[model samples]
Target chain A: MAFQLVLPDSKSVSQAPSPLAYAVDRTFFYAAAAGALAIILLVIYILWEIGGQALPAIGRSGASVLVNTQWDVQNSSFGILPQIWGTLYSSLMALLIGGFIGVSIAIFLTQDFLPHSLATVFRTLIEMLAAIPSVVFGLWGIFVVIPFVRPAADWLHDAAGFIPFFSTSLSGPGMLPAVIVLSIMILPTVAAISQDAIGLVPYKIKEAAYGLGATRWEAILKVILPTASGGISSALVLGFGRALGETMALAMLIGNANQISLSLFSPATTLAALLASNFPEAGAIERQALMYAALVLLAITLVVNVAGTLILLWTSRKMAKA
Target chain B: MTNASVLEKPTATAGAAIDCNIDKIYYGKFLAVRDSNIAIEKGKITGFIGPSGCGKSTVLRSLNRMNDLIKGFKLEGNVHFHGQEIYDKGVDPVVVRRHIGMVFQQPNPFSMSIFDNVAFGLKLNRFKGDVEERVQHALTRAALWDEVKDKLKASGLSLSGGQQQRLCIARAVATQPSVLLMDEPCSALDPIATRRVEELMLELKNDYTIALVTHNMQQARRVADITAFFSVDISQGGRTGHLVEVGPTDQIFDAPQEKLTKQYIGGEFS
Candidate 1:
């Protein structure tokens, strides 16, 4: 395309549309709408392809394909229950731990308690933490984090052994290790989004708090946090999404066990991990089982993402009212 | 200008509400305000009139130690509330702020219910009386209760600009502090709303001492007992604001001692 020199000549013509120009403009409008429609078609096509491939496995067991735990490759029986449990609980653990740490870091950095120059430096460091490759975190977890978590896991087992969640004994890579590494991996993502959300709160609101004789802690807790809650939650949603789909990091540390365990110390596998590990070696039925698991993961992600968006909208409406 | 013109006539210690002996305020090394002195009188309105960036708002903020939040903000001064120095060692800014409340130029209502907004200061101070009655009393005193009595639970932001300002006034007044600092409180309001606020200020003077910073000369003439005019002094490094004249409202407006104050009030220059 060449740059053309043209000035807007106000005197040349009226803004009223000509017949030919109107037809051309109408075509352009339809063209743009079709471009948007292409995305919807693409999503539907992928879903159809996946559904067709997995239908045989789904038809054989019906709902048991989701609930059954048996995976006998010799007899060709499979279930996604353990992987589902692993994915859900591990992602929840990651969200709780990572969301807490992310929000705390965001609050600390955004508060006026620190000098502006120093806050800027700390914020930059956290962003850099977010940019580190996931495989490196998984590797670091293998060498450094696994050792640290072992003693903590043992102590947890001893102190709360009566509890089902803390009953298992740890040897190496497991659910807890995977959860911790995932949490750390998502921390900066959460922090970065939360920083933006907290930063979006108007300065005048904080001033209002201080003007009413509020301490810095009071102002932040009572005013700034509530005002930024919508954005903060969106940050959490992004973190949750990232944790749900993360493959290399969780796959490396999850120990790739196919059985479900209530204990944090027990080894586990996730949907992404199962797909990564088994897809290369699987026969038709096993491959179908993995596809079914991926379908379930996709469904869960959609439900969760919709719920998060609704919650965010609810908070924003409340903000508008208040 | 004469010394008395630069600094207000010294009121008795017992009668002064808040007094400032400010050497300078600085952002890093750049001075914002220099050599300022003023004594606000008890149960009366003292008005600060000046052009923009003349440190009038800075002085208003300094009264409650609100400037402490700004990075690189350094002040060489002592602010006394009644007889005790507010910036003295062991005097917490939080506690100092509780004794003196401020209203901003913008009507910044907390993002909560109107009832909660009125109750914010009372709860902060741990008011040991009937909370509901106190909120009602404060709102009534701010002249917003009659309009918003039924919808107390409505969000503070749902109110009009003027009503929000009144809500803020009610919030500040709920603490029942000795001094009320208003920094152009009516600047964001409509003319009718501004009149209402001005009227409310006159009524409030019966119970509270007010130090007002305003851009409106007519507002000062109508409501202030003492008027202090500030002007920017431009020199080599930067412009520094300092008090140019201080006297009774009529004298300051009718016979401004400094040429700059005359230029300002006479509309010859800002």
Candidate 2:
């Protein structure tokens, strides 16, 4: 196709560009550019400082720092294998439990399972769960949650004792309670975002499904949920981030045991838990070890957030095309 | 298995398939529409032509209990579909909707693969046999089989506007509904896509009782066998829709009994 310069067929237009307008435009552009640069500068500064502080530990431990279990103070050796496993296992466990609960709450609120006024009240209560400080949750986990959950842990140990994950004897403050507390703390983050995602579906789409003879459950499962999958995945990512970086609550209740074990009943120390509990009493090498663990947390969060954003972007572009 | 010949079998035979006597419709005490009485004939296309907010779409939606979805929407009326009172105390809207599928004002193919969108209803209802065959038949009937047969796995939204509408039509027809309600099915398309959708509606009427709500008088004239004219009545609950006339398409267009109907069709008023 040949391109044609189609011009407006009528009136005279102003001929000259104003110098004042150009000045104002340039000033505004530079102001916005400066704001963006500040954020980049701040992130770089934090990463550089943390990396420099952690360099001593990183050089001494080599690649084995991530996988080696022992954290000997006298031997001057430090590794985070148990902490890494603890962080991964606890966060994954939290996701499995919290993700289900959050999605369920979101679905219930969005769908017609409850009356309008009732759903609103329930939604508010669930959102309120997020507003309470993490320290408060930590206290609750120590006193009430740990005691209340011991029986369930004992029951799991008895029922599924053949499995390595369930072989350990029950304890009040360990991986299981830590997982429970993390799941609770992250519930609102997951539910709130997932609810928003579910709400984004248009009424016309639901009407189309209903017109196709789908039951409410069928329509929800086959259409609405799939349509909101991107948002839900983003919610899970946020939940995972919250669970992974959680320090105060895990440090308070996790018993901070620094050894890897297959059993869920065994006490464990997550990266955040170890850093939070040991940072205040750290010597030169100990401080570097804590900073090393913090760097890993930072890297993981950055990766997770980027992946989550890409997922959201992909789904939105697909939605726009549709 | 042949597409055109299979859809050639006429479905509706005689009088009314859907009989409506809607006294009023309300959204939380705010009256939306009121007083509609019409007999939608079987095996033919019945066109509902009126201005905006004339309750043409409302009446069509009521036929299959689609109003049940709205939070505060309630209607005082009886709508009987194929001799069953659909508004009865013990009626399941799911079953009612299965028998009378609808096409929307906008093309709304589910955000899924073309083949999957067509197969959704069958899967939901747990079709016992040959899902792929049924999907193919539906697509073929909608006259989209030739264009999209090779791209069954492609997203339904990937198609052009006209093809998307046809895919939606295929989706609606997949479950073998006896009656099809369309609310301005061509309003969102270009002239070419509009013409294609209009043609598809005419072909589908042979196998389904079609109720269409349209603002386009030319479309009504071209496709409708029977026509219902509605206009806003100010006296009964303030600007509520009332059915003005219903008759054979030719008579309504050429020799309309109601002056309002004449004015509407003659372009005297909206």
Q: Model 1: residues >4 Å from true position, as ranges?
A: A1-42, A309-322, B1-12, B235-237
lDDT (Cα, tens digit) per residue for candidate 2, span A194-299? 9988888877889999998788888899899998899899899988988988899999888899878778888988999988888888899889988998999888
Q: Write the per-residue lDDT of candidate 1 for residues A1-322, one digit (tens) a residue.
A: 2233455765654345567877898999999999999999998998998888888878887788788786677888888888888888898899999999999999999886577799899989888977889899899989988998899899989999889889888879898889999998789888988888788777888888987878888999988998898889888987897788888888899898888888888899888898888899999888887778888888888777787678767766765554
Clashes of 2: 1
| Candidate 2 residue runs with Cα over 4 Å from true position | A1-32, B1-14, B234-237
Per-candidate clashes come to 0, 1
> Model 1, range B22-90, lDDT digits (tens) per residue?
899998888999888999999999999999888888888898888887878888988877666767666
DockQ of each: 0.56, 0.72
**Deviation in Å, model 1, residue B36 alpha carbon:** 2.1
